[model samples]
Target: MVATVDVRHETLRRLKSGTGKLATAALRELDADYRWFGELPAQERSWVGTVAQAGITSFVSWYANPTGTYRGALEIFAAAPPELTRSVSLQHTLSIVRTVVKVVEDNADELAAVGGEAHLREAILRYSREVAFSAAEVYARAAETRGAWDARLEALVIDALVRGEVDDDLPSRAAALGWKPGPTLVVVGRTHGPLGETQSAELRRSMRRAATGAMVGIHGEDLIVIARSDQDLRELASSIMESFGPGPVVIGPPAVTLLEVARSARAAFAGVVAAPAWSLSPRPVLADDLLPERVLVGDTGARDRLISIAYDPIVRAGGSLQETVATFLDCGRSLELSARTMFVHANTVRYRLKKVSELTGWDVLSTRDAHVLETAFALGRLRDAGRASL
Candidate 1:
């Protein structure tokens, strides 16, 4: 009997000589020597039959020994396979399939750069079943590498925080790192038109750049920033307006410390809440000193009966009754400074003073009455501040 090796060598020589298309040559060679096809494994035989039926010439040679010396020659003549026409050549269809499987297997580094171990496992499950032999092994290696990279990145972030590598202003630096503290300024806004996520992120970055020493955070749909100085606060406000267009930003005043931010935030929130009309206009409203008159007006009830008796009616009238008293006291009862502060002609200032005297039956020019009015005014403001809280 002829040796199997001699039979294999003769078959290979015949295949090389037959220059018809890969599938056609394969079939012709197999027909001349049917024993070779008979010797193939069941799966290989089935694959060859499927390739013939699909009119794919490249896949015919895949049933041959995958790592044989003739493998390169078979691949060179391969045509596009059926479903894999977009992916690889038909003559060397098995090699093409193997390459695709390898890519998904090797993607561990890419995935790890974006995330880490968590993502590595996810990627394996995502692409494994879709790829060819040994794909699971490839993905496993990738996941391990990716997980390691992610851990490194997280360590870096924590190290930066512990090392105090952030900026000098405590509040601003903390805000950037998503820390919560007292004395934060909450800024709430809704865009007038649609914006992409990229645009929103860029806008936030621009605001931070402009503010320099401000800490900015995102709460739901709003931007909250904490500034260490009035200058940073002002710049942040201005930059936001410029970027978003002229709309109002309601800012709570700086809390005395981190612990006081909540109270300051409440006051600022209340100021905006009271003025719903300005919500559509997009102006910046400062919570601390801007609404002092209103806060003082509301606090008038805190005064003892003597002070209330002097200023209750004037306060109820909607004008700033507390401010008039403060101005009077600040001017040392001088009508000139009082007039300038009240932004009125001296005569108009005199008229209001006259009215105050009449309300309490206290003479405006009396030394005793001046002292009484001063005390009453201070008490009324304190009362208003207290009432505003309610």
Candidate 2:
């Protein structure tokens, strides 16, 4: 037992004395074999060297007391800044560990006492396994921290857009979370329930797969997704509709860029508020399609959109379209009744109705389009009356 203790002491002294050489050899091997390490920035490369040295020193300490607690093994990674994990992936870190272990094993003859090389080699392998585990734990903790921060930052950006409280910092904050400048759309709907962390992660993964970039915000049961892409937002929204809870999923008009995102958010949320009124609407319906419903719920933006899209064009055409539509709708969309009331032939009423559809893009014969047209005309007349009073 005394001779075995002397052999361990001799091996420990040799390991302590050769740690600097082992670290340098490991770093030289990294620079030669790993192209990524060679391309690292000067400061980051220096940090890598520090980590290699810290790892060697920590291994020596662990070898000196093999039966002692392994609690202090994590300090090996503490030699570098937290941001190091961002650039160095877990695979890359494992490669580093492998290279360092190889260097130590190659020098076992020089670093161990007489007849102790085999034991030292085995010890090196065991210590390297622990180091690999330490590296994984460090990266896992870093990812958890980064993910929590990103979630909070994303929520702030989404809240600003929903409330129209946008500031200069919004774009910067979103950029920090990897949002790029591109077309933006807002989708709002209820969720199955408040999302737990695991479910939220899965939902975010699903959304990101559908868009160039996406950020999800959960407000109670309401789940809001801000997605950016060059593809048609309505089509994109349709693809992701299944992610939302069963109910109306309202998609806002696409904004040209992030700076204009609040406009889309406002309309989308208003559509959600008005969605229950139209139970037969598609699973994912456009906010613009809900304009009449939104106006009924007191959205000024929807009222203006209804007038512009359904009312102003007919008035601008200066034909009999405006008067003819009024008569047809007032007569319950009956061409014969409208013709008798307007003292014209039924064919003339039909021609004018066709012209109205051409001008306003809403077919007077369809129940839904006719409702939009009727609401637009009423709002237009009220607006004109208000103007005349002024």
Candidate 3:
């Protein structure tokens, strides 16, 4: 027993004296073996060197008392900045551990007592295994922290959009979250009740699978998703429609890039407000499709757009279309009555209606399009009358 104790003491003494050399040797191995090691920024590389030195020093202390607690493995990583966990991946860390162990093993015979090389090699293996596990814990904790921070940042960006308070920082903040210049759109809908972490993560994963990039935010009962994709925005919205709660899912118009995403988000938010007005609207409805409802709810932008789309074009066609449409709508949409009121052939009235649909893209024959056209024409006439009075 005394002989074994003396050998152990002798081995520990040598390991303590050579910790610096072992660390340097391990770093050399890293530089020689790993291409990524040299590519790390200078500060990060310095941090990695600190970590390697910490590991060797800790291992020597653990060797001094083999039966002591194994906290040294964890303390080794504490020597470096936390950001090192991100710069050096878990795989690269394990490689570092292996290289350090190999360095110690190569010198074991020289460092150990006359008969202690085998015991020194075993200690290296055991200590390396503990360090490997510690590295994993460090990386896992870093990932959790990073994920939490990203979630908060995403919520902030989404809130800014919902409130129409976007600034120049929005694009930069979004870029930090991996959003780039690309076709993007916003979707507003009800969330699936309340989401726990697991469900929220799954929903996010599902959305990402459907688009090139996706960010989600939950405000009260609302689920807002901003997605970028090479695919059509409408198709991307449809693919993720089932992820929302049982309510209308309104898709904003696509933005050319993240810098313009606020416009899309604002339109989507407006659509969500106006969607309830259209009770029979599709689950994934376009914000533009709700123009009439949006106009009814005091959206001046929608009112102007509706007039431009449905009324101005018919007047611009200049074939007596405005009078014919107003007369036909006033005559209960009856061709004969319209023709009689206008003193024209019924076919003439029919031909004018066709031209109205062709020019305005709103068919007077359909109930929905007819209401849109009627509302737009009335709004347009009201605006003109106000201007004339002015």
For candidate 1, write residues 103-173 as lDDT tens digits: 32343343233334343334334332333333233334445665455335433433343233443454453
252-307: candidate 3 lDDT, tens digit per residue: 87787654677777777788889999888887988888988888788787888888
TM-score winner, 1 or 2? 2
Q: Report the Cα lDDT for residue 302, model 1.
A: 22
Candidate 1 worst ten-residue window by lDDT: 55-64
Question: Which candidate do you rate higher for lDDT, 2 or 3?
Answer: 2
| Over 4 Å off, model 1 | 1-188, 192-196, 212-214, 217-221, 229-232, 245-247, 277-282, 289-390
- State candidate 2's TM-score: 0.89
* Clash pairs for candidate 3: none
Which ten contiguous residues of candidate 3 have the minimum total lDDT?
A: 256-265
Could you tell which candidate, 1 or 3, scores higher by TM-score?
A: 3
Flag clash pairs in model 2. none
lDDT of each: 0.47, 0.86, 0.84
Cα displacement (Å) at residue 187, model 2: 1.9
- What's the C-alpha lDDT at position 8 in model 2? 88
lDDT of 1 at 70: 32
